[model samples]
Target chain A: METVVQQLLNAAQLGAVYALIALGYSMVYGVIRLINFAHGDIFMVGGFAGLLLALRFTWMPLWALMPLAMLLTALLGVAIERVAYRRLRQAQRMSLVITALGVGIFLENLVRLGVGPETRQIPSRMPTTPVAWLQDALGVSVTWDKLLIIFVSLALMALLWAVVHRTLLGTAMRAVADDKDVVPLMGVNLNRVIAVTFAIGSALAAAGGVFFGQAYSLDPYMGIDLGWKAFIAAVIGGIGSIEGAVLGSFLLAGVEVLTVAYLSSNLKNGIAFGLLILLLLIWPSGLLGRPASKKV
Target chain B: MSLLRLEQVSVAYGAIRALHGVDLEVREGEIVSLLGANGAGKSTILRAVSRMLPLQGGDILLGGRSVRATPAHELVALGVAHVPEGRGIFPSLTVQENLALATWTRRERRHVEEATRRVFRLFPRLAERRTQAGGTLSGGEQQMLAVGRALMTGCRLLLLDEPSMGLSPLLVREVFRAFQEINAEGTTLLLVEQNAHMALKIAHRGCVLENGRIVLEGPAAELAGHPRVREAYLGEAGASSPPCPGTPGSSR
Candidate 1:
């Protein structure tokens, strides 16, 4: 039971981060219907941004650094959209995919030029002091780090829900997803809405990057695997729904963590990917999505 | 003076020209019903004015300035809002969000809230289902939501495409009545409909389209009483204006 409890906490902690990253994937897909291959590296750049900030400005509160990282990465996301995506906005998905791939290669190579393709420590962004919890009932003492991860993640999710549901910008986003062509008729500037979408989505992923750096290790390649996993989660949870992204992340994380604990540690990734393949084979629409039906 | 004009506008889908040299206009503050059979380039005019399609040639002018080459997104700034067929309400969005999306440029939260209330008053059904997802709404409610969404845009000029399609007679009456109320409030409406009788009944003026051209156009009452329109369009509304079979099988 203790082992199971430990695995559950581990899964939740990891799932929280995946949920954040998956939002980026899901939102971009919702608005543009593009895979956005560079999205994974946006997280990478965010971690690096946090890393650089941590190195240069050590005195600021840890909380400040996290948001700053998100802001920085969001700005970069906008820049990437401007440079790579803007021209391709009118292009076919296939053309956009190719451009996205090229951008990914460019970002990876750009990072290589500066940071040189090496693994680095995220540095302890949170305090090392442990906070004990639920040892008596669940027999698993949750650390402050994991607790912060879970609490902050849930908080971010709540905030996102409010902004998206309460604000006009959120409506524009939903409408834009439904029909990008008609929004301009409502007097909305499509370019501005799209920029804001990319900003918010990338910013969310950046927060996830900061969490990921603390929860795991930092590597350029880290975003690739994590990005792929999050995409699978987005697909599994229903690609366009934000709730679906979060739910899917938790499910994928639960499976992966449980496999790591009971099943072969080496087979952890294989199990995750295996489940994704099986899922897509059965339900291509994701768990929460209704298959598209339209009157011609 | 016309509020909207299409001067020899041509729209093409690849090699096939959907609208070739189509000319149309909407006078200021007038409810003009554009009537046509399917594929008679009825929708093509709206699409061109809304600039949703790539214009192959010719020009569209709103308020006498050319808009043919303008981006589709900028049309909203020109005070033109299109209520596309199928409502196009964001299925995943709640009723409030669908309304709120209309105020993107309004910026002031107060006006946004006020517009929400106004739209709610106009569409009490939407107000009742304020928290409901748009996907869950009935067809009538969805159409109401679409009209409400357009109202949120604050555009004085509205282009409605097939607003009465797929609606029952009762719902259709309700929709046309609401459109009348809207037009009464100083908003200009250009309505496209398969329900020509209902459209002409509400409209101040009307135009008849066939095979991508305007065959007849005049005051709503005059056009309603016209023999050809009476035979082809108004009979569906149970109006005994003309015999059902014109010349016994005249290529309907």
Candidate 2:
């Protein structure tokens, strides 16, 4: 029972990181209908941004450093949209996809060249002591860092929910998702809404990158693997739904962690992907995604 | 001076020209209807005036200043609201959210609330469904929501494209009655419709667009009685039909 509880905690930590990254894919897709294939590289860039900020400002607390890194990474995400994606908005979908792939490759090479092909970790600032209550009563070992990661991620997600559901800017974002052409008719600047979407999505991914670095290690190419996993999570939970992404991430992480723990570690990817395929067969629009409605 | 003017405006969709040097005007507090068959370029004129499509030549002026280079979004602050074809409401958003979105340019909380209350008053059905998702509404209710949303922009001029399309005759009457009320309350209207019989009844002035040019323009009553318009648009059989030029069935 204790071992099961430990595994669940491990799954929760990994799921939190996945949820943070998956939200970007869902949001950007919701507004523009573009897959934004370069999103994974943005995660990698965010990890580096966090690492650089931590190294440069050693005295800055993790709370302060994380936001600064997010801001820096958000700017990069906006710049990428402006330089690489905006012009091809009216062009063919294939052209946009190809451009996104090119941008991803460009970011990967840029990071690899700048930082060299070396794996690095963010210096751990989170409290590493196990929870006394859990250790004494439940006889399970769960570190403060892991708990902090899960709680902080949930808090961020809650903040995002409020922004999307309660605020005007968020309403405009939802409006853009529903019908891009009509949003401008309502006096909302479509470009400005899109830019804000990119900024928020990228910022969340940066939080994920920072957490991942603290928990595990960061490499320039880490985004390629983890990014795909998050993308899959977003796809599994309706691609445009914020809640769906979080749910999908946790579900995927739970399956993978359990498969590795009780079954062969090599079967983890196969099971995770198999579950996605099986779920899709039943709910083609995704678990929470509304089926595509035809425009009259 | 006219509140809105198109000084020989032309618009092209790529190689094909949709509006060919169309000249028009709308005085303040008037309902001007543009009537034509499909592909006759009625909607294109609205698109050009709203800045949805760039003009290939000439210019559009709103209240004397040239709006030829103005973007679509800035028109809202200038008190121009466009209710595009098919009732452009955000489906996933609730009725209240749909109305609130149009108040994007207005920062005053009091003004937004006042405008929203006025919209609900104008269409009581929408008030009942305030929390319901916009897509779940009936066609009539959705049209009301669309018009209500336009009102929320605090617009001086409302541009409506095919406001009567797809609704039953009774619902069409209800929607048009709302338009008349909206007009009576001091909002100028530029309405485009294939439902000429209904559009002419509410309009003070009317223009008949054929193949991108204003072939005929006059008082709405006069155009309603005109033999050519009677035959082509109103479905009245003319005594001497001359191929019914530019009607969808006769167009080459």
Candidate 3:
């Protein structure tokens, strides 16, 4: 029973990180309808940004360091949209997609050259001590860092949900997602809404990067693998839905963690990909995605 | 001064020019109907005025200031609201949310609520379905929601494209009556319509557009009785008279 509980904690921690990254994928896709192949690279950039900030400001607290890194990464995201994506908006879908891939490649190379190909960890800021209550009650070992990561991520998700569902800016974002051309008719600036979307998406991904860097190690190419996993999570949950992305992340993490625990670790990717294919066959629009209802 | 004036305005869709040197004016507190066949540049004129389309020549003036350089989104704050063809309401949004979105320029909470209450007062059918998704509404209700959404912008000038399209005759009369009320409350209207008979009846002045140019312009009554308009637009075949010269093919 303790073992089961510990594995669940592990799954939750990993899922939190995935959800952070998956949300960016979902939001950018929601507003622009672009798959944004460069998103994983942006996640990589975020991790690196956190690492650099941690190294420079050794006295900074986790709360302060994380937000600063997020702000920096958010600016990078807006710049990417302005310089790379905005001009190609009216062009063919294929062009936008190819451009995204190119941007991803450029980010990867820039980081690899600047930071070197060696893997490095962000100096740990979260408490490593096991929670006394959990250890006493459940007879399981769960560290404060893991608990903090999970709780912080959940809080961020909640805040995001409120912004999207309750706020005026968020409503404008949904309006853009619903019918982009008609959004300006409502006196909402379409470009400003889109830029804000990118900023929020990137900021969340940066938070994920900071957590991941502290928990694991960061290499420049780490984004390629983890980003794909998060993208899959977003897709399985429904690419354009915030709730779907969170649900998909936890579900995907649970599956992966269980597969490695009960079965061969080598079969993890095979099973995860297979689950995506099977789920899509049954529900082609992902778990939470509304079926296309565009009026003619 | 005219509420809107289009002076020698021209618009092009790539290589094809949709409007060519068209000059027109809508005085304040007047309903000016732009009557045209399909592709006669009626919608194009509205698009240019709302800054949705770039002008290749000439300028559009709103209250004596040239609006040629203004972005499309800012035009709403400038008190120009356009209801495009096909009732452009966000289908997934509830009727209340749809109206709330148009008040983006209005920062005060009380003002937004006031504007919303006024819209609900204007269209009580919309008020009944305030929480219902816009897509679920009937065609006439969707039209009401679209116009109501426009009113929430506190616009002084309302530009409508085919407000009568795809509605039953009864619904058409109901919407036109609402427009009369909206105008009566001090809004100027530029109405584009293929339903020429209803448009002429509501309009104070009318202009006939053909092949991207104004072919006829006069009081609504004069255009309604003109032989060419009667034969081409009103579907009234002149008895014992030859086909009116330059009569275009029937509008779809």
Error of 2 at A57 (Å): 1.2
Estimate the TM-score of every prediction. Answer: 0.87, 0.97, 0.97
Q: Clashes in model 1: which pairs?
A: A184-B73, A187-B76
- Candidate 3 yields a Cα-based lDDT of 0.91
Q: Write the per-residue lDDT of candidate 2 for residues B53-121, one digit (tens) a residue.
A: 899999999999999889999999999998888888799999999999999999698989898888887
Please, what are the lDDT tens digits per residue for candidate 1 over residues A241-274?
8898999999999999998888888998999989
Looking at model 3 chain B, which ten-residue stretch has the lowest summed lDDT?
B243-252
In terms of DockQ, the best-performing candidate is: 2
CA shift at A130, candidate 3, in angstroms? 0.5
Q: What value does the TM-score of chain B take for model 1? A: 0.90
Q: Which regions of candidate 3 fall more than 4 Å away from where they truly are?
A: B238-252
- How would you encode candidate 3's per-residue C-alpha lDDT over B112-135 as one tens digit per residue? 888888888888999999999998
Instruction: Say which docking band candidate 1 falls in.
Output: medium
Pairwise lDDT winner, candidates 1 and 2: 2
Candidate 2: C-alpha lDDT: 0.91
